[model samples]
Target: MAQDTARQAPPTAPATPARALLPLILPALVVGVGASLLLLLVNGVAERLQDLLWTNLPDALGVGRYSVLWMLVMLTATGVLVGLVVWKVPGHAGPDPATLSLHAVPLPPVVLPGLLLATVLMLAGGPSLGPENPIIVVNVGLALWLGHRLVPGLPGGVWGMLAESATIGALFGTPVAAALVISEALAGRPLKGALWDNVFAPLVAAAAGALTTALVAHPALDLGLPPLGRPDWGDLLAALVIAPVAGLVGLCAVYAFPYVHGGFRRLGHPMLALPAGGLVLGLLAALGGHLTLFKGLAEAAELARNPQGNSAGRLAVLAVVKVAALLVAASSGFRGGRIFPSVFIGVALGLCAHACVPAVDPALGVAAGVLGLLLAITRQAWVSLFTAAVIVASPTVLAVLCIASLPTWLLVTGRPQMQLREDGSPVR
Candidate 1:
């Protein structure tokens, strides 16, 4: 009877297999550190080259560093050089960048060098895009290729997740951003274990990456804006209005993306297309001044440092010109990301709001504008929220941002995203 009772009892489900997770820890740490180093290396090289191009060479020639003629020459030349690399380099720089999102298929090893070269050139050449997309692609490709060779038993997805999370952590100088981004991505897929169990390795990687970056560079996102005190009804009102307006402004760029990309494609070759795009960017630089150039990180900080430095008209022009430049850079054959430039646009718009309406807190305006534009441009809810909050670095604004996201999300939810399909149509 005891034996019969034992047989009738349901077999215990296999234990959660917590021991299986132990093997991933070392690899995750290695990938995390490696990801941070690569990001630093790429940015470091680009910064040196940028100094040479913008400062040293211009100084030697006795030309104004950011004069109209110099901006025109430098940007046009940058396009030509980048176009040549794309035209002649093997793998054609790993496909047109417009079709790529943050999470893309791992590229072959052969394609990485050219892609890196193109990305570096774009960074130094004053394109209105950031290092996020291509750098992520490079890190993911390296991680997968090396991980498979080193540990033949693990799934390719594991390496991809590690590299992605690590790179994101490194980019933002905090593991929380990586966690948020990965959590959002994982929410759509089926899982075998508890969510935290599944996230264990990636979180380790992200933390390691964030630590490495912080130790070396001490990166900080806070703009040192005035403190936002406890949230009031007025602050909430400002967030709601500014965020949606920024969303609609960003939507204008989203709607225009396909047409701009299509126009560049009709040029028939990178050689013609990139130079033409550069010329257009030069025109924009002349109108918006030098502050609107580059990936927009330092430029945005500069804008934030003295929000009242520019008149309302000037701020509006800066915002509009930046949006146009970002579109041109992404649409042309340039290899870069959109997030940094979007941040700049949001900052400019936020300042513009404050300039128009003094009742709105500048910090609130900036955070809300960032939230709305990032929502429209990247379509990553958590990332948008995290980025918006970090810029202000105030707990009080979080409540306002959360409430502001509701209306902004509604405006952007059903619309087309900023990315393109393989066929050159906007991804809806």
Candidate 2:
């Protein structure tokens, strides 16, 4: 009888693991599908608008696709359009971008349309921003709204975490990146359970989100640079030195963010502020040319295609112009995220370092350059290292990057961040 009881207990033991995983699996699927659909809807609209701006409208006007005057007209017009949406639409199209972080309380359903409209205009108008923050907000709101009806047992915070994780995973083109980012975020917070217990659901959601995006429309974050050769002592030294320099360059932008945001906020209305900001952006774009426009992904690729082709001075100019553009777009009431453009700036800064020292391994130079800027801009060491490594896809450089980030972290640890506030108080 005892033996029979033991056998019965074994059968129930198998059920425990399955039961434990089912909760995670179900939420992951829901969040993943939701995230993918949202991305497709948002990206699809922006792409069409982009086509109209670049192709149909230019053709209709009988102007070159990149005619300087037409570009200026469209950008200025875009700002006006976005301003109208923000001013007239519901929820004021969410909060001020300058005042928000990568994570925030989920916005309400009423705010989605205006936010979407503002985002579309920003992307099509060639602002130095990306769809990251807006889309994340949208997804998080949608998830919470639906989760209440569909999965009432789940807490609001879980939905928020899952939604953010899924979106970050999809945007960066990898679940692992999202995992690391989330881990860093959850590292010190007091919680009720094991860290993995909380991390499990988010990871599942991230994987599903990444896979779904891959099937529908994949984003490529990889830089595909030439592989690093055998380890070199000289390259190691270069990384240590170059990373801190990159941090200093990024610090210029970080320190300038709030002041720039405050200056634009002084305009006091979207109608006046955004359009004025846009006109200034247009002038800058004209000087920088088309290469300096947009969120910097495509242009970064263009610059990377021939890093050596650009002189150090030109690369320096590109970095400065982009930082200025990012400040303008982010501060002046644009609906977007800073990460993508920051990555581009980091790339430009990295290539600038390579240009100055032709003998430094290109892989090491680029990785270390990115490391410094990301450390200062993001203030997340793990994210900075992973992103730097992903740009070159070289394991050989990882050890050096890890070591280089130490000094960079020290340089940026307690400094002001690139964030703003509604009441004009300091970020802390």
Candidate 3:
């Protein structure tokens, strides 16, 4: 710890000679490579594990109906893992909100391991969360500790640049909107480097991160890139309405979720809570049937590919079932992320919207609605914009989604809202 502090301690000189800078640069590269390797290894192993757990576990359990009882088992275990993480990890599971934005970097290194473990469990188990959150947790966490210990007094701006670049780099396969997100977050703060340096660091880091992710994650990593095309007036107006609706729903989620979930947390025992929530999910599945489990992208995609076969309002029920299950999983403290659930919400929203205007395409509607929610709630314009554009193959669909997203942003921003968390405390 003392050695780390000494490394981070700043010298009186404002600018270190290029020669002096090399030492810091070399170590940073080493750390970057090491972190990248960890990411790859973790991702590859997790993918295989996920498939094994998600696919083979059910059969092994003799749950002949393909019921997601296995998911329940996985979630329950991860729940315990996350509970331990929150207990031992200093910042508590993944990135804090401030750290989530650019203003903050990784948590101090002393507690980074638990966060990494919690993140791994989240993926291996099946929370709706994504690689992005955990990736940031590990990367930024390492960067912050290294910058503090090894590169101290090197200039806060330089550390910030490194952390930010690392984050941007990790999102390589996806339309991470790194440049755009970074630009938006750093709108006010002034970094130490010149314009070129500022841009170059994140670009390189993001490229490296993406490459590393691809090597590890393989076929799973897709940026959802869209072809460039102009959308019409209708698309723009649709976007305006869509964005606000998504925001409203997101706010509702951010709000009502706690009240709804607090009921379960009150149970106070993982043993009781997991079984109880599992029972509830099982019941909902029996009632809602088929829709009560994970959005199961492959399942949703299959349904989309064969829309005509779905009669009996199956899509609608599936949407509601997902909403219920996701809320339960999160509210009950089951370990997982929200993006997977949110994707279902977006898809459901699209299914409904498609019915409204026969003129607007179904695929287009799905793309637009999903992006709308992403924009409204996440405040991540680039991420949502890219997500909306990429999921489908058609250029026309992409154009519509992009145009529609503009209005959705306006709608979400216009609302007055409060966030709801399971702990009964208001989310700041």
Candidate 4:
């Protein structure tokens, strides 16, 4: 009789009831807004410090703000400062950044302060990395720590997902990017429900985060390039050639990543490795000029604003130097993301393509270049496509970008990724 009763009961529902997800909306909203605020605060503080170091202090000292001497001093000093935090601060700033990813495990709350401090220092000190990875880690850590305490019934994974989606949305100032990224992440995972059911909460969080950031920061990703009216065969041909070439360029960095990271690890300590890395970056900076120094957003914008300002050779130099700088900073002890720097490299390469072959539309070159580099570096297909398309702010470029991505994706797939494993090997 007991067996009959047990068998008669229906199996647990395979999908979550739509109403079951409704309760998550409020928490998602809160997490989303908080994530954006955190990003804003970090960036604001970094920008202020950057101004102090590069502008006010330089003016007072009567030195050119971007002089080779100043660049060397600042970068090396940044390494020392960050190294001190990593060496002395508790938890050693979480983990070796080489082993971390944009979707890293939530770090202990104890590690958050030191990690953030090191990240801010890297940003202000002019490393060729972006705030995305560290910032996402910090947000995820905070959300899980706080949310678990406040709502003990909910799983930590829920909080982590909300935070990650929220942060990505804030980073790009669009929930669409977060959705695409999260969807890609969800592709192969086991699921108890429809994909939309699983994504509902995250989408809400992402929307809130994106809205908060857009309202506060007014950030813009569009490059304001002249429109590519229609992609002719010539344009298609340019995208195909330019994207793969750019992917090859980015793959150069990916192949070298482990070796570079291994070199720094051999230095035996953050104190030595970071400073040495800084010196190398300083040299790259001097070679590439001030435009190549920071995380590449503003600099990429500067490049796009006046593509005619630089010759093809000069643009090529900028692209190569930025890639080298990114590799060095990431492989060393610096705490930041590779995405922004990759964007800059892509833009420079695209502009160089346009300059070399005036018949190729600048927009197509830039978009294709970004698509290839992003595919090679981040290995996130949705993000690569989204970012490349957003750069030009044109739907017309999508058809070409879609086709261009095929060859680029094929080239990048199965290659050693830019990320490193715990054993200091590349993730293949």
Cα error, residue 313 of model 2, in Å, equals 1.2
Q: How do the residues 1-428 of candidate 2 rate in per-residue lDDT, one tens digit apiece?
A: 99888888733212234456567688877797789778877888888989988899899989987778977887888899999999999998999888777775688899988998899889888989988889899989988999989889988998988999998888877788779988888887865456676678889888888888888887676676786888778888998898999899888988888788889888999999999889888888887778778888878888877868898898889888888899899889999987778778888888888898888776777788888988887787887888888878888888989889989899998888877667754464
lDDT of 4 by residue, 1-428 (tens): 99999999966537889789999999999999999999999999999999999999999999999999999999999989999998999978878888877786788999999999998899999999999999999999999999988998888899999999999999999999999988999988887787888899999999999999999999999988987897899999999999999999999999999999999999999999999999999999999999999999999999999978899999999999999999999988899999999999999999999999999898999999999999999899999999999989989999899999999999999998988889998888
Query: Across residues 1-428, which tens digit of lDDT does each residue of candidate 3 receive?
Result: 99999999965324434564454555444544555666676666667766776677766767644355544455565566666675566656543221243233346666667666666665555544445555655666667666678768766555555555555455435314566666666667665544444455555555555566566655342223232245567666665565566556666665566665677767875556545665665556555555445534544465556434454266667666666666666566443445546666666666666555544555655676668666544666776776666565556665566566666666666443223432366545
User: Clashing residue pairs in candidate 2, if any?
Assistant: none
In candidate 1 the C-alpha lDDT for residue 44 amounts to 93
Q: Whole-model Cα lDDT per candidate?
A: 0.92, 0.84, 0.57, 0.93
| Models ranked on lDDT | 4, 1, 2, 3
Better of 1 and 4 by lDDT: 4
- In model 4, the Cα lDDT at residue 290 comes to 97
Best by lDDT: 4
What 10-residue stretch in candidate 1 is worst by lDDT? 10-19
Whole-structure CA lDDT of model 2: 0.84
**Model 4 misplaced regions, further than 4 Å:** 1-15
Model 2: worst 10 consecutive residues (lDDT sum): 10-19
RMSD of each: 3.8, 5.7, 8.4, 4.2
Q: What residue runs in model 3 are displaced by over 4 Å at the alpha carbon?
A: 1-36, 68-74, 77-105, 172-176, 191-196, 219-243, 261-304, 307-312, 334-336, 355-358, 393-402, 414-428
